[model samples]
Target: MKALTWQGINELAVKKVPDPHLQNTHDVILRVRRSVACGSDLHLLGGYIPAMEKGDVIGHEFIGDVVETGSGVQKLHVGDRVAVSSFMACGKCWYCKQELYSLCDNANTNPAITEALWGHAAGGCFGYSHAMGGNAGAHAEYIRVPYADGTAFVVPDSVADDRAVFASDAGPTGWMGADRGGVKEGDVVAVWGAGAVGQVAARASELLGASRVIIIDRFPERLALAGQFSEGVETLDYSQVDVDDALREMSGGRGPDVCIEAVGMEAHSEGVQNAYDQVKQQLRLQTDRTTAAREAIYSCRKGGSVFLLGVFGGVVDKFPLGAMMNKGLTVRGAQMHGPRYIPMLLERMARGELRTELFGTHVMPLADAPKGYELFKEKKDGCVRPVFVP
Candidate 1:
């Protein structure tokens, strides 16, 4: 099988690797049909993710067709179309029962979900890092899917595979970020970083009936997508215009009622030249993903809510916490629990209530992944969300 392997810092290649076979009764085999590069992949690309090992496969969001199922897997069968969540959890864990799937006790107990009897924090995840169970991810011809019945959501036939791809990660992630903001009808919303995730968050706000959606980004291309997603949304080009002024104007002299920080530690801000300077002297692709997260806090309306959906594993510099406290705002971060929303989001996709495909400005084959990462990092226009076909 040809797996998109992350060999080391700033290193990636399509290499032939061993195929994944069933390792446990609950395991299943998936032949990946499609996948995409996410901003998080920059962590792997820049070697910022600490748990990652050399030669690790590093993508989390993907969908595949089931080629085989383990004996204990009853909910899924061969030939089923499914979207795999970034994380896996045990159905019967303390956290899983509470709907905090990331904290699933059983999933943390073992390297492979069904191979052991206790809990470990490392849930079996594909294409993540060594700390995430070191499993090969969906950036391959075929991947071993653990806890298939728990993590893989059966995508409906009504949705095209291109659109269905986002449900695995960015789409639902954006949906979850917006929901975490607790947006209400006619409320004002501001979203930072108009990348695929940020664009979707603004769209989610629109779906929730937000009266105004303000998007912040230096990249005109993604901000344009935010505009296309909703007429209510206004763009703030952080590169040219001042964000504080833009937010004040858009929110009637106040900041947005709800602010979503879709760009996490990967965000770039003023003063910091590049986020990856510690790892290498190269220009940091993660700068936009992290720096934008901090700006959302400063630009949020007083007493508003801020949701942090972007991935930031390490320390970030220049976050203005004093302003957040004085503003009396609520700030939180999250990872999307696909099972919680994939079915509903998929239903909405079926109904056309979510036109997230507007963010899919580019779609190419899996072989073009390295270029996709480069383009996404550069914020290339007409390539908002690029999916790779294997």
Candidate 2:
């Protein structure tokens, strides 16, 4: 099988690898049809997330056809088309019972690493490195999906492959931030970053009845895309305006009711702070960047809430704990629990309430994955997400 592999830091290659088969009683073998690149993949590409190894296949947002199914897989059939969750979970676990699938106890195959890093192990994520179960990713001709009935959702006939694929990750992730960030009717919401997740978060806010949604990014293309898909959504190019002042003006003197930081550990900024963060990161002193997060916390209304949808691997410098504590704010962060939101998102997609096809700015064959990844990583040619057909 031909699969995209991580050769080293900032490196990717499409190489032939061993094919996957049924590995567990509830496992299913998916013949990958559409697999897309995620901004989170950049962390692995840049070696920010530890436990990544040479030649590991890397992709998690995808939709595929079930070519084979294990005996215990009752919900899925051999020919069912499905979108699989990026995080693996055992539906019977206590965390899973509470609908916090990402915190499932039986998912991460290698628990000692994360247990040591964060005091508890999170659920496994496909191709997210050895620390997250080391499961083979979907960026291949075929991939193994464990806990098939619990993790894979059948894509509705009304939804296209490109659109349904996002229900696997970005859609669910963005929805999680807005739904959990306390977005309410008539609330004002601001989302940091204009990537797929941010754009989706903006739209999710609107669906959740937010009166106004604001999406921030330095790139005009991404901001434009956010406005296109989201009704009544405002966009701010962070480089051109003072974010705090702009947000305050938009929210009628008060800060936004809810602020979402989706830029994650690789967040970039301008001026002295950017250089300081860069120096610290390069010196191995800081594992994650907090430019967007700090701004989100500082710009949020005193009684408002902030949710982090971005991926952060380790310790960060200069988190705004003071403002968060003083302002009576509610701050939360989580990896998306796909099972909790995917079904609703898929139904929304089927009704055209969520438009994700626009995010697939570049689509190509699996052989061009290296080029697709390069374009995606560099944000070149206005490529929002490069979708690969394997």
RMSD, one per candidate, in order: 4.1, 0.7
> Which candidate tops lDDT?
2
Per residue, candidate 1 scores C-alpha lDDT tens digits across 1-390 of 777788788778877888889989888898887888887877778766656776776688888999999999999999999988877866877777777665556654335532332233544556777656677888888888878888888888998887788888887788888887899999999888787788788888998989988887777667767767766778887778778887888789988889898776655655445534333323442233356666678888889998998876644445678988999989987666667777788888888766766666677777887777777767665566667778
Q: Model 1 — TM-score against the truth?
A: 0.89
Lowest-lDDT window of 10 residues in candidate 2?
Answer: 223-232
Please give the lDDT score at residue 238 for candidate 1: 74
Q: Give per-candidate clash totals.
A: 17, 0
199-267, model 2: which lDDT tens digit per residue?
Answer: 989999999999999999998899889878888999888899999999999999999999999999989
Q: What C-alpha lDDT does candidate 2 achieve relative to the native structure?
A: 0.93
Cα lDDT listed for each candidate: 0.76, 0.93
What's the true lDDT of residue 39 in model 2?
A: 96
My TM-score estimates for the predictions, one after another, are 0.89, 0.99
Per-residue lDDT of 147 in model 2: 90
Candidate 2 ranges with C-alpha deviation above 4 Å? none
